[model samples]
Target chain A: MERVISKVTFDLAQTSLRQVNHFLHRELNSETPKITLLNPDGAHNLAVGLDATIDVEIMGHTGYYTASMNKQATITIFGNAGTGVAENMMSGRVHVKGFASVSAGASAHGGLLVIDGDASLRCGISLKGADIVVGGSVGSFSAFMAQAGRIVICGNAGDALGDSLYEAVIYIRGQIKSLGADAQIEPMMEADYQTVGELLAQAGLSYQPQDFKRVASARQLYHWNADADQEY
Target chain B: MCGIIGLLIKQPHLRDSLGELTVPMLIGMGERGPDSAGLAVFTQTLADPYRKYSLYSGGKDFPWQDLSQALQTQMSKEAELQPHGNQAVLTTDLPSTTLKPWLKAHYPQLHVLSTGRAIDLYKDAGNPTEVADRYHFKDLKGSHVVAHTRMATESAVTPAHAHPFTAGEDFCLVHNGSLSNPNEIRRKLEPRGIHFETDNDTEAACRFLEWRMREGDDLATALQKGFEALDGFYTFLMGTADKLALVRDAFACKPAVVAETDEYVAIASEFRSLAHLPQVKHAHIYEPAPEEIYVWNV
Candidate 1:
């Protein structure tokens, strides 16, 4: 574990922390490495575009898009993350210790994203091939445009749940307001319970699988049925 | 609720002065920073550009040439030269605009607004369009711009303290935060012949910028020094003829957002201000990094 950034300097400190990803991508040849930041201020896009199998721990509250475009590295934030914590994530996992803001896992592709606390609006908007598990309630417009993957909500969900969804699995335990145009409540089966339990355990949440309801898209908004088409 | 805007173009293009772009935004802010308003516009006038300058006009002459002269002379052979065509002509040809008297009656202090032939600033109490119309800023264009509207807290509300404090040939600042150690910096800058008109924290900010520029520091370096020495919470934006810089206080209390694409880079206090622009597709809006300075060349 060679410490890359232990203390801030004139060159490294002044360079935008966002560029740290570019530097890492260009310099580091090893696949599985450990990196740490001594003074992790509100830095956005810290470990973005990382394709290697690595472990990164940011010991402070991060700004927007902390592990965006992550490919194969596991990133853990010790503090709260701003909007779109793991936006467009491809693979690996991103774990947040505190609450996340709007668009928590927006348009994610693959891998798992776990939020330890509450999540804001549009938690999994435009979700694709990714699994997102939240330990608490989610705001309005969650799971909108979800093309694939699984989204498990351990707590309550705000208004407009699964609005305009596209073949994404949603599991919620608590109350849910009006569903989106294509969203519908479905009975939780035996396999759904096990899957929800596994996702909850991965998100570090303590809850029973049967305690929640499973909601998903009916795939009504997937294709444009001209006969029934009005507007998107 | 102050208004802040930053523009950085990769190619050579005319910059919309701080007034033309920010007046509307400040007008939108309403009375958030009604006491004063200021702007810093940057342009690439020379082949290679140096981004800041500190103008010390009212300072008493010392045994040797003042800091401005010595540094200008030292950096003259680099690429660009200081205001050399006519210092007397520039001083005497000061705009006959009514802001001087308006400032005298309204803002009695913080009048360090003289920079080279360019770097003109127009600000006062009232609406942003009113000030823009009064100064005819719509026609004034440059490369980079930064503007601010002021709301008086601890200092007297006046026009002289209005933002866009011009230091030298083409250096200016528009600040949204307060300075914790004004007296300390003032004590050091005053004796070196620096004269201040306003008691506002921004005045000290202008003076501190001028002092750093005199020490041969560029806009970004001066801003880095500003973030280090100037205590208290602040979200200040500065500009030279060819550079734009943003500095945040150590605490990161104030808010700012930066958005960039292949075409342009825009910054503002709120994302809605930038939402109107169509080019902003995937903007990463966030708070400023604590104690960090972000600078861009025009």
Candidate 2:
């Protein structure tokens, strides 16, 4: 016996984002899967707060907070995504076929956010434990204040790549204009290469891991002291 | 929070659809700012010898015809007043320097939204759709348009407090974040003969830029100086007679997206505001870096 996949479609032009989100919450679960969102038309807060192992596809561009706080949902945006995509996600995957605006994957705990095109400023800002892979370039402050996670960029990185980073690994294949406070470029070991290779493979990218540089925190500025203010 | 949208048509053929294209963008930002809305339109038709001034009378039905007759009598020149709901556009051959002061000295109640050779402004405190309909915004024709929906974080909601603040002739600015040090800057500029109309912090930024320009700095230089002087988390869209400029604060907390096509350049607080634009899918979309100035010339 074969199992049937339940697929639901919602057109945002005729329906509100709230109604779509409500339908997603009420109908989506581990048992019933798949939703097709049409005519997103850059609406914000679409498919937010999803905690099921379902497949959600958005046909067009979306505004802020798209697929934010996702626990276990495989979401794909066919078009561009606005600010804060997949922010604070716990699990599953979110893929963007087009460019992502500022804070593409900010403060996510766990998930795989794959951006096919360039990501704007603060791509992985305050990231906790997610894995982000960008197929194209990323804007400045790529991993600012990231406590934990891994970010792999197949292309270049903008200024101040990993500012104030902590316990997070950043891999960039192209040039890094500048590094932020307490962030330093480290020699990639064999294990680090393997990690980058795995992240690229998971994001369905074919970049070579040997052509990348690893950036990590120096751990010197972890603790503050009033007496160490001579530079100020 | 506030919403900002700007459209500058590069193709001469698409210039007539500026207002029709801008209404949807402004309305899309209704969730971000539901308090009031304002817009400024620039057309080539207004490039004649006459100057146009857009004025708001605080929702009052003022004697616009009488004011126009008086202005014609006093200035000894032809003047025309066209009213639209609570706002009106006054066109005259008088220079802004003479006309603005005269209007200020006489009708203090009429708030001048903008004055320029090619710009006309309209704004009010209400829903963005209702405000746009009241002024027949969909029927307006222009080469470029800049619109704002205000949430009023720093000041009370009034017609005077709506955005697209005009400081210099043909120059207007709309802000999306709060300024931390406006009063201090206001006090500093007050002694230099810079007059302020509203207590809104955005007005302070507008006046500061105008003052910088008055000091012989070009628009780009003034904006670079603004990065050093202004303190806040802001994304600003400023318009001149022939250009549109954008700048974000160093922190880049506020959101802004810029999309450019061969036919046009559009900016908005979010991507949704620009999603309805023509051929936006093929447009090159990106976010401006913090402290970077992006300017588009006509």
Candidate 3:
């Protein structure tokens, strides 16, 4: 039997975010189909708290917290997204066709977030587990306190890349202003090359993995030492 | 939190729509800041060689005509007074240095917002839309504009505490973060005979840049010096007669984005503010790096 695909549309200027989210929640786990949102016009907290295997498309620019706390949902933003896009996501994919603002994928446990355009400061802060692929440059303090996952940047990275990171992998093709505490440049091996190539392929980007520099934790700052503590 | 917007038009055809385009961008961040709003518009030079001073009066129905008449009599030159909301621009043949001191000594109730050959500033403590309407912003035509919507982090919500603080003859600045060491810098600038009207930290940063420029430092050199001397989280959009510049702190804690098209260069605290710009879909968008100065000249 062919599964039926259901479609829903909400214009935020006419309807409220609460109403739209409520309808989405009710439709979760049913057919798990497509939803369209229009006239977002920089409104905050849109399409939040979704835990279904559904597909959502936002037509215009959105404010903070767009597509946050997602689980098994494929969300796409046709225009720019404000701060905290795809924040704390557990699974699924969120793709931004336009630019994204600060804290693009903060504290996401799992899933893949792809930004076709540039992302601003703190692109992947405190990521427990996730894969973030940015086609354009990312601003400073990116991958700060990252616990796990892989972040691939096809363009340049700003200052303090991967600050205080633990066990996470960061790949950048362009210049890095500075490396953060506990983050060190590591040579890209065959496995790293294959992994980055796969992620870039998934992101629909065609960049050579050899062009990127892999970064990982130094493991020196993970354990607290009395002498090191005294230096602070 | 605050919202900063700047639009610099490269095409002559788009110059008339500068204010029309900026109003919506400023209002888009209404949620980030609702306390006050301000803007500095740079228009074509006056027909005659004259300096324009933007002045604000706390009270409505300010005696602008009387002031103009008084200036005309005192300075023995033609003076024109144009009022918009609580703000007014005084155009005169008198030099800025002489006119500024004379106005300060005479009109204690009026506040000088800015003085330049092409810049006119307007601001008020109210909702962004209301303030924009009050200033009749839709009717304004300029080559570029720098605007701010303030949330009042460290200072009182007054007209004087607004952003887009004018530093020198045509230099203005708008900030989106708080400074950690404003008083210390203020103390250093005061001994150099720099004047201050508000306790806002943004004003301190503005004065510091102005003083550096006065001491023969160019805009780029002054801003580079500012990166070393100024402390705190900040994303600044500064403008002069011919250029617009952006800079962030080393940490890049505050948010800022820049988008450029063949027609114009627009910057805002968020991408949402830049979404509606003309040819934005094809615009080259990017985020500036920390401690790196990006400047665009007309």
Candidate 4:
């Protein structure tokens, strides 16, 4: 069968990448579509909520919700992305070559989301299955309310990262503000570091695995007792 | 919303006595999902059939007596069904080999499904205390469990979609996060005669596991494939009859923490979930590895 998305096209001059999504929805019948964003300056939601076999390559910066609710596609944002990039994505790969704004990849489920640059507040907030590898720092409340998966922050994190979280895994190489809710800092053994190292490598991020510290929940928030008037 | 908890022990002594430990643990998590509570207990029976006990309360479904009586009559005989106001319980004794068929025959209303070696489930609309009081969780004890306290974003508030669903024998799951590819996966699985009860995305995860299991993939391998195949945000806790496992989506948008020592290992959405444990001395907590799978054997 013919490849889902075979041709490479650019709509920078055409303006309104809306047609791109519409075209993709019609043409690429696969769960993921192979796309090439040709230096689009201000495209918003270039590939959000597309559940086909598709791969997207953005050569330039993007606007909000670049890949929200994505499934089975590989998205590469060659330049910076605006607010809420990859929000609530389900399955697929999202790679930002440059910085991303607040809530990048927030609440995403199963998939690999890699950010080559720094991210703003609520990065990965309330995140579910998504695995995030940030090459740079994360803003406050990273992985907040996170239910599962791994988030490796290559740089420092802002205040209250991982607050009130459940079972998500986090690894950071730099300083962090107070841990939120049940989150805690833990030592990284060789076996653990090796696993972290390999995951980072798979995300195409390079760093000294030893330099990172691991963050997780203390398992306190999973329960609440009314008679005791306590919240876990 | 509803509350759920599943545990799997590594040691045989711990496994056999799981009922004792799990009864209280489920009650402890009851507050997180207070709207309704239910517990399913599994015991190993090589000679006899696999045994499953389910206890829950009918919170606002109808009057307490009416709901309880209906449940009791529906789950009578083979499964001991008891309803007490906001809580109810059901027990079934079966051989391990017949667990799958037993679940299919008796708990079809639950719409059970599996994920890797663990079962996946959904519970809607209940508080932890309400769940315990309604489900009679005090009577439940098992080697392993995985539960949830639903905020009710999607799906109904019915008991049919509650957490700790069973896919086959000895498997259950609790999850946090949304699945994006449920329709696609559902469309694929429905043709295979795999039934569905609710509209929740987690059912896709269960069907994904069932598909992988049918293909002869081991639990861990199936989970890894789930990591690659399923789409959406998910940080899930799963339990077999004798083991507990955790799986996170690639983004890790949600949070999961683990506190461990030589004696016990506790996982939760927050530290307070395990803070009640008296044995937790200076608990060291950390997040699951990205795209990682953690298993505790019983």
Which RMSD values do the candidates have, in order?
18.9, 2.2, 2.7, 21.6
- Which candidate's lDDT is highest? 2
Native contacts kept (model 3): 0.37
Model 1 CAPRI rating: incorrect
lDDT of each: 0.67, 0.89, 0.88, 0.66
Top-DockQ structure, candidate number? 2
Write one digit per residue (lDDT tens) for candidate 4, span A12-89: 556457777777667664334356878555356788887776668887666668888888778888876766888988
**Model 4 misses residue B193 by how many Å?**
0.9
lDDT of 4: 0.66
Q: lDDT, candidate 2, residue B218?
A: 97
Instruction: Point out where model 4 deviates above 4 Å.
Output: A1-232, B1-6, B9-40, B45-125
TM-score of chain B of 2: 0.95
lDDT of 4 by residue, B1-298 (tens): 2333445454455544554555455555554455544444445532333243332333334243443354456544244434444333333453434544654565443322232222212233456555554444444444555666655456666665666555655565666777788898889888987877678776678767857777898789989888878888887777665567888775566655565755556676543355445454354544564577888765
Compose the digit string of candidate 3's lDDT tens values, residues A2-120: 88998888988799988988877885556757999998867788888788888999997787899899888899999888889999989999999988888999999899999999888
Q: Assign candidate 2 its CAPRI class.
A: medium
Among residues 3 or more apart in sequence or in different chains, the pairs in candidate 2 whose N, CA or C atoms overlap within 3 Å are none
lDDT of 1 by residue, B146-201 (tens): 67767767776555666767654566677766778888888888899887767777
Error of 3 at A76 (Å): 1.9
Give TM-scores of chain A for all candidates: 0.88, 0.96, 0.96, 0.89
For candidate 2, write residues A1-232 as lDDT tens digits. 5677888888998888888898778855546568999999888899998988889999988888899999888999999898899999899899999988889889999999999999988999999999999999998888999999999998888888888899989999998888888899999999999999999999889888999999999887788857877441
